[model samples]
Target: MPSEPNTYPGYRFPAEVIHHATWLYHLFRLSLRDIELILAERGVVVSHESIRRWCLRFGTDFAAKLRKRRPKPDDTWHMDEVYLKINGELFYLWRAVDQHGVVLDILVQERRNAAAAKRFFKCRLAGLKYEPRRIVTDGLRSYGVAQREVLPGVQHRTSRYLNNRAENSHRLTRRRERQMQRFKSPEQAQRFLSAHAMIYGHFRPRQHLITADQYRRSRNKAFRTWWQETCVPMLA
Candidate 1:
């Protein structure tokens, strides 16, 4: 039952300020300067650099807590890879999502070959209690080759048309990429995205499938859960 202030010792700003700034940076296409401006508007003077540091320090911690709270991902995994232009170099971002559109894992790699696919498969499969019932992916020969090698028994359906669930998951990363003027490095992209996917998905509920009131309730619940996980420890 510890509050954020109690836990974050020696920090100048309160836990709320740090958490809010991190939230704004990830949940929107806003830049660090934009976040600083917003906080200043509320009479909370903090530099953009400070906000960035806060995100780098605390974003992953919050995201880990949120991920721990997620239900076990569905058995059907949709996998896809997209090329990301970073520092004039092309890197493929491999992402896997469940049928419910929950991001299961993400990896930034230099190649989109069978070896890269195998690496992603191992990373995503780690810690899961059960192998997926099926995996859906685009018509990539690499995926087929890796599947046969790493997941011989799991059913894999390879089709560009059937993998919308995973392909669409990349939109958020694309939006952030443009806003940030493309990622500076693979390590930076991986760190930010590892936290970004979890935190953003924690707040975003499937609104189109529910009524307005239901959506509102879900939204409220999401925020409440965020506050508990990021700003305070939840009691058992």
Candidate 2:
């Protein structure tokens, strides 16, 4: 992996503090004001608006670093689309996850038709750098239509019950939507959800499949990776 950038020359706060606040915001369901209050308790007097700016500026960089550290996704991809309300306008949020529940890619679009599905499929294929062996979806004919165009030879399964992994992955997004009261625009929703997926996917493991000791080890490793990715080292 490439080395993280060493300096935030113009920023008044240390990179450690800035990145920590960003991590807290995305890793947990905390609002900007909530982060400000938490920092106040720690004797850091930064404003909520600053926290928001830090997230907007550096969230994607942190997420990109985390994505580099992730393992290659599984070949069986599960795809789903959910409707998001922005300014009382309905938009489609398309997401795909691997069998292990790692998010592959996400896109926000105005429709859920074949064109939208094809765009989403192309996005995932380009981002992940390969086609999946099998793609599963919740009986969406658009998925079938798109797959035939973009991934003609890949296996496509359409079933309501087989795509629970992708459906369940939306729980966090739903919580965040409720907390934010709804997104203001399509661009904002896309940016936030893309970064959110990478950060959340980094820390989330299949807890039910692992023993306690293994789970603890996994959690610790995730924290260590987060620290390395986000913090610049102090001078000697």
Candidate 3:
């Protein structure tokens, strides 16, 4: 039998498997079964059930590691929500982005009302150490209420077209969701999407949807940093 591949420090599964699982979760938006099939094509013998177990066991810890390695978001934040389907039921996924279009955080909830919105702001938004100077969001009154309570003095804008930046950010998440055949539950959606948000924020080129020069430079730097820091192991 071939020798089993090694893993990262204190991890059980091969680091290659964990890395592949993480990439599959974000870039391709594949479920455990889909990831199993994909790896099988590459001659890695693994079961869908095993993939699921690996995700549940190590997914959150891997996400936490990525977050710890990421830089802080810009000072200005834009918030928005996109519709998500879970077990054929509808929900809203609240996402926040900084001025440069870097994703900051995401919250999955059943409602877009004041209560849900308040929880998003109070819980997810509050956790950020880099308190934004200004916040841009849609003309939702819930946002106003949350801002009044949580970020009282911060400048808040509620214009229609002004929030297009955030609205556009939702498209990427929507694309990823479609690939996964939708989430199974709100909890699953939240956990998976949070990891997605971090991965997206890390690798996305600046102004990718627009300018090329900036995109090229930003993408090169982002990938270079990721390769150096993530792919190469640090000395103990």
Candidate 4:
């Protein structure tokens, strides 16, 4: 593929360095200083602050490109919400994933009420551009209310056991939450989680469902897509 246009204009660092640093920060649960130390060992002198800036600036762009390349989500959707403590204030994080474990959308809201549920449904459905065949969730009454208003005709299933896919998706976020000592604000949590989901979704295929060779091919393809999405454009 031909190179893409310069995405980091006027920055002293090359796109490769910036991209690598950003990737490390998101793809792994590493702190900015950890990334700084890793880069320093490789003979590249850079400050943690600079790495933070690069991530804040370019991470969303990379994620948007990755999402643009994803196939439309499956017809069956799983939705769930988890609690988040931001500055000691409790918040709800609503998340939706397809049957294949692909994240459809996420929202950090102040309540887990019917309105919050409706808003999440509206946001996710608007982005997907198509109605799902079935919606699955736990025994949350808010989900029923939202489904009735937004997706009245779609099949709605409520079973905690069946909704494991969506619930399991929160594991990474929980780990990252602990690592970062919890988010300072809802906006920060939303931005970081939104980008994290896309980047994580791109790289994480269904490992248990595929053979070793298939897994390797899938990972390689994901890496190639990442390189094309983040790196190739710079050369243009």
lDDT of each: 0.89, 0.90, 0.75, 0.90
Candidate 2 vs candidate 3: the TM-score winner is: 2
Instruction: Report clashes for each candidate as comma-separated counts.
Output: 0, 0, 0, 3
Model 2 residue runs over 4 Å out of place are 1-7, 234-236
| Residue-level lDDT tens digits of model 2 in 95-182 | 9999977788899999999999999988887755677899999988999999999999999998888899999999888999999998
* Per-candidate alpha-carbon RMSD to the true structure: 2.8, 3.8, 3.9, 2.9
Worst 10 residues of 2 by lDDT: 227-236
Q: Decide which is better by TM-score, 1 or 3.
A: 1
Order of the predicted models by lDDT, top scorer first: 4, 2, 1, 3
Instruction: Give the number of colliding residue pairs in candidate 2.
Output: 0
Which regions of candidate 3 deviate over 4 angstroms?
1-5, 8-13, 29-34, 207-236
Q: List model 1 lDDT by residue over 1-236, tens digit each.
A: 95445346768898778888989988988999999999999999999998999999999899988888888887899999999999999999999999888898899999999899999999988877788989999988899898899889999998888899989899889989988999999999999999999988887877777899998898888888998887654435
What ranges in model 1 sit over 4 Å off?
1-7, 233-236
Question: Candidate 3, clashing residue pairs?
Answer: none
- Residue pairs in clash, model 2: none
TM-score of each: 0.93, 0.93, 0.80, 0.93
